[model samples]
Target: MAIPRLRPLLLVAVLLLRAFASLPTQAAARGGLDPSPGIADRKHGSSSRSLLQDQPEITEEMVRGYMSNFELESAIQDFGRRCANISRTYSIGKSVNGSPLWAIEISDKPGQREAEPAFKFIGNVHGDEPVGREVLMQLAYWLCDNYLKDPLAALIVENTHLHILPSMNPDGFALRRRGNANNVDLNRDFPDQFFPNNDDIKHRQPETRAIMNWIKQEHFTASASLHGGALVANYPWDGSRDTRKQYYGCPDDKTFRYMASLYSQSHYNMSLSKEFEGGITNGALWYPIYGGMQDWNYIHGGCFELTLEISDVKWPKASELLVIWKQNKMSMLNLVASLVKTGVHGRIFAADTGRPIPGSLMVKGIDSKINASGSFGDYHRILAPGQSYEVVASMEGYRPKRTRVMLGREATNLDFILDPDGAVRRTKPLRNDCGCSCNDNSNTGKPFLLREAYLWLYLLALFFLLALYLLFRRRMALRLAAHRHPPPKRPVAV
Candidate 1:
């Protein structure tokens, strides 16, 4: 009687265990589970500190000078109202403590999507580094104030969609800690290329998930996250496969270097840094960190991102915020302007349909690929200035087109119209015409057939699983009834 009662429960437990056992482990996934507490301060000679060390306590004195969460929210809302013509305010998501993660989008057409490339500036990734949040607000207002009067400002406003999220980890900001409300470091919360376990979306923190979703929706061409504690422009790859502290360069190393140099050279004194050559360093070389946001942005979001450490002191006095903003103002403006002033912008279309085809763009010798927009089939490829590149546009069922062009200081516009593979095949005669004598037909049709077969197989398996679950429940109910009311043993007439 006891055995029957425990059987169903035991089976259910076994199934659940099996299901969870299939989940990827941290070691198997190749990502670190915990945040790199000291990695942010590695350049400041604090790499030897323990990961569990208590964060610097924030006192009433510290809170006295900085803007509270309420004040920052008010400032953002006020900016939206004051710059209504050029900006739109929206919440990306909420932080762990339910603080709305607000963003200010600045463009001539603030809410609408255009054929132009989009750029994002995220600040205050860590709660204690509030300098970026303040500086970003200043950057927004300055652009609004000087759009028509300043050529660089006017160019950025008219040509690009600039999205600024002044604070990513607002809960951390309110708590005066490096991590969010749950004590998760938002910077190390992203999925890492070296560590696959971090790729589990369900386990990611709310702030990290919000950023991931935002990047997917925005289709940003390039972005930067502002930080404190150092004065260097850092670019990916942020970590190494062997977990060693060394230089690791991604496919777009040259382009990233160019972007980083643009910011450092434009700054008042960043280029003069004695530690980092030209005030720029590869992220891994500076200090290796797994699940960092910069590398993930480049690998997954298709947005080239630079981690800009703008100040030497983290949590600098609020009075010095304005001066810090001034020091980095030109660097900020020039970085955004580089999107429109440089790069190769173009669209892809089908020659026969005369309609846009969502294709991909690739450069010769560069392993990375840039995808075109689905709606307009437009693409923006950022490259170092004064170079020649072979750009290729490709899509399924269409012939790939390749072209060579010289990119100067100004952006080049290139378009591609691809001919259908079948159309090209029609021009040539086959040796035999049994309607199966074509290589192109076999190449395309097999994939479609395989896809359809897989769809049916998935549906069938789902139905079978549902039926098995129902049968198990029915058997458990019948067994419970037998246990509750024992049948008379009168049938023992052997």
Candidate 2:
């Protein structure tokens, strides 16, 4: 039976309704995602919104006016030549029509070279969602152009290795189609290795192959794929159901929630109360999507993946591109910065046996908080410093843990071995219960992990190696091809 096709506008509206309804419950219970600390109750008036909502509409005319064929090619080439240090090129496999699948790497540190965690900002996975391409391009340009002028830009590029494949489905991009040239949905092609894919079987597309290959080759810390026509950020590892029945959570669901909430706070203005006004966990803005880029990245790639629907429609007007960019730019910056900050470092184990506890922990300080380390023995929290703070650590079959730590000149490392009696211990909920301590933001936050000086040196080394490789290989390949062509017969025939 043929599936009924819906109009683009209707489909998007429906998707939004379904997504909004599916926002996870804010209950701090089993299989529920909770909101982090420092989540403001009210919007930051107009200034905050104005800063993010800079780009209003992206019309087709606007896209065509600035983003021409020549400009697209030039952007790709310029990225290859100018930003050679922070990135490398790879094949995404092939397209349906047999084209070279190209992906650009944007790592602050190399694969062999160890540093902070890595991330990939993939765009145009659906081909027609072209707004992501613009976002990625603008981000890269800003990073390169303001490497020295902007401290934040330089900080992000220096500490983080950001891999970006701005356009994943060039064939569909060329055709202006949502699906690939083969008419298959590229977003629905990821194979579920950890859990079985419960939806319709539509695996094994070329674009999927390329992404899978890249992910398998280089393990990233987190990733976000850009989509258009939706004004929400989706995170996960589920098959359209964000519950225990379909997709409960990732091993690092707590961390995913922390990061996703950060993006939401910085951009979407979505509070816990309004997060689920659309749906439960199935067909809403906050629902889980199975066989999705985010899910696959979380389960298979071991990286946190988020599906960022930039606009309110699948095909927003090109004029809205810049507006979406403004909305997303800072959120993206915050996410990268948080990932590199290397939050509160501590140890978690059994108080009785001093055995390590393998589970999740949450630590809250001032206006920022962090999810502790994935490794149970030792944990780290990424935080924004200043003010007296509190911490909480909990895992299944153990009593919840809470304490306070002060941030100052040194990295705060607290060691906790849970009591054997903690399994049955009942604890009271600790809030900012008192106004006793002083609240001050006088001191600026510090980088907990990779320092700026070391980060720049690493980025410098990465670009230097990339330059030598490209120069030497291009020269060799050109010479070999020239030898085979016999100097083009000296153009004598003309």
Q: With candidate 2 superimposed using the best TM-score fit, by how many Å does residue 162's alpha carbon deviate from the native? A: 0.8
- C-alpha displacement of 262 in model 2, angstroms? 1.2
Taking every candidate in turn, the Cα RMSD to the unseen true structure, in Å, is 19.3, 26.0
Q: Where does model 1 exceed 4 Å of error?
A: 1-56, 425-494
Which lDDT values do the candidates have, in the order given? 0.79, 0.55
lDDT of 1 by residue, 1-494 (tens): 34465566556656654543332211100004343545445544532223234446667765676777899899999999999999999999999889999999999899997778899999999988889998999999999999989988888888889999999999999888898999888888887777664567878899898999999898799999999888999999987776566789999999999999999999989999998999999987777777888898898878999999998877777778888999999999999889888887777766565567789988889999989888777888899989988778889888776666777887777666566775632222111111211122223421112223334654565566667666777887899998899978777666
TM-scores of the models, in the given order? 0.76, 0.55
Q: How much is 328 displaced in model 1, in angstroms?
A: 0.4
Error of 1 at 428 (Å): 20
Worst 10 residues of 2 by lDDT: 29-38
The collision pairs in model 1 are: 29-196, 29-197, 30-195, 31-195
